[model samples]
Target: MHAGRRFTLTEILVWTRREILVLFGLSLVPTVLYAGLGWHWLGMPWVPIALVGTATAFVVGFKNNATYSRLWEARQVWGSIVNTSRSWAVFVRDWVGSAPPTGPGFLDARQQLIYRHVAWLTALRFQLRESRAWEHMHEPANVEYARNYRIAERETILAEELAPYLTPAEAAYVLGKKNRATHLLALQSQQLKELLDHDHLNNLLHLQLVPLLVNLYEQLGRCERLKNFPYPRQFATLNLLFVRLFAGLVPFGLLPEFEKLGAHFVWLTIPFSMLVAWIFLAMEKAGETAENPFEGGPNDVPITALSRNIEIDLRELLDELTIPAALQAENNILL
Candidate 1:
């Protein structure tokens, strides 16, 4: 996500430059026709158009509110994952050896459990980063802006990334599965079972740990739901249609209103109308970009950076010396 206080005017203009140009043309065309060609008949009553503008504003507001809800929900799910991950680390470290005569596999089991959880995080973010047909990342403006920062999932290989955390056999098994994150959690359950059988973990601790796995499953499923089910397409389509419709009316609406000031003031339609259209258009664009929170856009949840942080925190809990540094944002974007 954008790490700065707010986007610079330059960045906002750069992102919407193409649309602004279109708005300018839309405004300038009618102004030239009415002012130069004496087509004063093109001017329409402003009251009806003002009603359209008000309706468009309500629609845009609804869209922005819905999209922001999706983003906030995604962030909440990730926050849960962060807490669950730390709890998992603590459980594996402290509770796995409750029985006397902790087996030779004690440390190995702890490391395996924690590292595999990290692997699960890696797999999940990669899955979430996968492109969807409805996402705006495929649009030219979003595609161009993405070059300003890196998407770690796009740059790295998932299997190669999962390699460090899983044993050869476990990695192969998980890679073979269709839902890698779900299977990884299943493996965690199975490992807990094996630990219980060997007395490395007692019944009480195993029962507690199993619920943690379930919580992870719930969080993972939450993220998947947001990823798979897009915001209602009908609402999106209508929102865009209404915004464009009002934008088209803006210049004609302003024409007679400006002409009241003076004949020369009719030329004011170009800039004034363009300004109004751009405001609505920019608001629509902002909602569109934020609607999909996991589509690898700059405005998306910084899952890669969040996953790296969870790893660092979990590893340090294990007293490991080789933990990687937390990820920093590039060009004021964290994803």
Candidate 2:
């Protein structure tokens, strides 16, 4: 989400301003009390302060490294998603072999299959995000639970994507649940089976499609990984506590050394606490948000936008034009 750029000053201030005020208020009272007790009583301790700073740095560094690992992993999985999508499109085009326009040939078959493929990607994206309602996702994703799925639409799309790719007798090999991609493929395989039954296709087409099934399985694994593998909660909670502790201690450490005799210079502790508190807290909050990249944060990827692009890519193969514009988020923090 941050890409190569660090956060701006404005972003930090806005995110941490409230906590800064609270830290300032909490520290001001102690600073004034300590000052009222005078320099004689308020003996400064630098050792503890140094230890706290060291601890703060260590924790920050460790947590940051772990958080970025998660971000990078999510990005890598999506990269595979992009690659597999292109591969699928290419496979469809080749498999269909350009049925004649008016003679139940390639183009018509390709059109049907491409739309279903695009729809599956869209559904899968929303399902990964948990963004849309369950029922709403069925048609687009093509993998609706039986109770949730409508039969007519599922059959239609299945027939379209597989029609050009599979032979009729091979299509009859369809079995089991009406999964969108699987159903289409099984039917296509049935067509191949039929061709084999009729001496049309040999075992070569079967061999070619086996790898495609393996790739689909890999994509499914990737989807499962993103949805399930969140950062450990205990680690995130501990780091959060550590950041707060660091923020709170900054004032006590500096108040004695920085205090001036003129006026109520003790107030410096408030701003000092505010400043350090803001920096550490903002960083901690940001790190937390980014670790779970799919849950809809300001800095999270625009999955919907990406899905639409996928849809458009698939449709362009058929010359359709109902596609939407690329929506860009301001400040590079896409939701």
Off by over 4 Å in 2: 1-8, 36-44, 97-109, 131-206, 260-265, 321-323, 330-332
**Model 1, 1-335: lDDT tens per residue?**
99989989999999999999999999999999999999999999999999999999999999999999999999999999999999999988898864432223225788888888999999999999999999999888888899989999999999899988887788888899889999999998988998899889899999899999999999999999999999999999999999999999999989999999999999999999989999999999999988999999989999999999999999998899998999998999998
* TM-score, cand. 1: 0.97
RMSD of each: 2.2, 9.0
**Best of the candidates, TM-score:** 1
Summed backbone clashes in each candidate are: 0, 12
